[model samples]
Target: MINSIIKLAFGIEYDGTHYCGWQRQREANSVQEELERAIAKVANHVIDVVCAGRTDAGVHAIGQVIHFETKSERKDISWIRGVNSYLPADIVVRWVKVMPNAFHARFSAVSRSYRYIIYNHPYHRPAIFSSGMTYYDDFLDIDKMQRSAKCLLGENDFTSFRSSQCQSKSPKRYMMDLTVTRHGLYVIIDIQANSFVHRMVRNIVGSLIEVGCGHQPENWIGNILLRKDRQLAAGTAYAQGLYLMLVRYPLHYEVPQSSIEDFFLIPLLS
Candidate 1:
């Protein structure tokens, strides 16, 4: 007889510095492997999870969403606490909910958001070392970065900003929003899009830095988009500064809103 299957969705937060990203890798440690191992101990069987986005190595996430099918007979809280008890200190399962069989972690997502944090300061702070914040000594002009960001606010071909190893079928994506702001010595770049090509956010931020530093004109971003040549854009930014902030879904899923707001670089807490 086929076991009764249940689909569960979980919100996870992790520091990606210690692992080789969210996807399972054969050669090195990965966040996926650790999560799967913990989940399997609770399920008493193999458990496979599909994430909303496969974040790259050293890229962190505060609102990562994932789903898995299981036949385990356990309470919802058991899945949360039991899994957490087995997981490493750097990774935690924030929330858990039963999802409809039709729901999916990746395909059901309507949009995904990311935040890039740059510590634009002359001296490095030991407190924030290797904590997913990129350090840059140059002063960044927030006004210029904001002006250049407007050119990417709608659906467009992002070939120039995509990674050479991108596996997406098309280069077109709809950018819902892009904002550049400063918090003390940090430069925060928050972006939301229907989807993204591999390393798209980092690539755009790298070029924006050039504009903010006055090395490139404010309109240079638009020109790069028009050219559709990856070679013409700025180099990809460091992965440590990137955080998969949120993944939006339709209301039917009822995913919880317990996002880790403290981790974001924007809006200093009052």
Candidate 2:
């Protein structure tokens, strides 16, 4: 007799400071590697997980989603505590649920959201959460950055903002929303999209910083989008400040959304 297959979805949170990235690597450590190992231990067999989105090295996530199939049946609490027991302190399984076969961690998603946090103080760099966020000493014009970011909304080819190493078949993505907000010394860039090419958010943030610092005019972003040339954009921003904040699935899936308040950095801005 064949055993029944069970599909499990997980909400993962991790600090990517010491890992190469989300994907497993041959040589370097990765969040995926650690997570798969932990989950396998609980399943009593090897299992692979598919994530909602892949994040780069030194990046972070508050609401990463993943799905895996297992024959071993266990309570939800068992999966969470068991897998977490084998995982490192920086990575944890926030929640787990039995998912329908039709639900896919990557494909079933409606949209994804990301937040980039910047420390804008000129005199001193934060020592406590130094590796968790980007430190930009230059004074930034919030109004200019806000105005420049508006051009990125809607569907468009983002070749100017994508990394050369990006392997996506197309450069076009539907930008659902993009906003720049400041709270005291913290500058936050929140963006939601149907999908993203590799390093697209960081590259856009770099260009916006140029506008915020008066190095690039407010219209430069629009011009670069028209040019569709990577050379016309600024260098990519640091990976530490970027977070995969949320992933939205259809209402029927009942996937839980991650809270931004769970992150330690949120209190500083609040």
Candidate 3:
């Protein structure tokens, strides 16, 4: 008799401060590597996980989603509790569910969102919210940043904003939304897209910061898109400030929904 196959989906959040990235790397410690080891302890067998996005080193995530298949039959809560028992304190399994055979953590997702948090205060650096935040000492014009970001809202070839090491075949990606807002001493940049190129978020943020800080004109953003040259854009921003805020799948998948607003508004006070 053949054994039945069980596919599972999990929601996880991680503080990526000390992690090399989401993908397992041979030379460095990785979140995926650590999570897999924890799962192996519970399953008593090897298991591979597929995540919605492969965040870069030092990047964080609040609503990362992953899927894996296992032979062992385990309760939903058991997967959470069991996995948590073995994982480091920085990683947490928020939810677990049995996914339909067709569900895929990466492919089934409709869109992904990221938030880049910037500490704009020139004199004082924040004690908390430091792990995934970028600090800028220059005075930034919020109004110019908002208008400049509007130029990136529609589908376009993002070659200028993609990394040279990117493996995607095409630089084209659809931009669902891009918003720049300020809350007290923090400037939050929220972006959603069908997908992204490697370091695309950081690259875009870097250019936007140039505009925000008066290094470039508001219209310069559109001009950079036209150039299609990576060298013409600003340097990629630090990975510390970027967060994989959420990944959205079709409602049919029955996965939980997440809000960008609530997640971004958490108090930074330690």
TM-scores of all predicted structures: 0.95, 0.97, 0.96
lDDT of each: 0.90, 0.93, 0.91
Per-residue alpha-carbon lDDT of candidate 1 for residues 91-149, written as tens digits (9 for 90 to 100): 99989998999999999999999999888877664265557788887889999999988
lDDT of 3 at 192: 96
RMSD of each: 1.7, 1.1, 1.7
Report the lDDT tens digits of candidate 3 across residue range 158-181: 999999999999999999999888
In the predicted model 1, the residue pairs found to clash are none
User: In what order do the candidates fall by TM-score, top score first?
Assistant: 2, 3, 1
Off by over 4 Å in 2: none
TM-score for candidate 3, please give it.
Answer: 0.96
Model 2 weakest 10-residue run by lDDT: 258-267
Q: Where's the lowest-lDDT run of ten residues in candidate 1?
A: 261-270
Can you give the lDDT of residue 115 in candidate 1?
Answer: 91
The Cα error of candidate 1 at residue 143, in Å, is 0.8
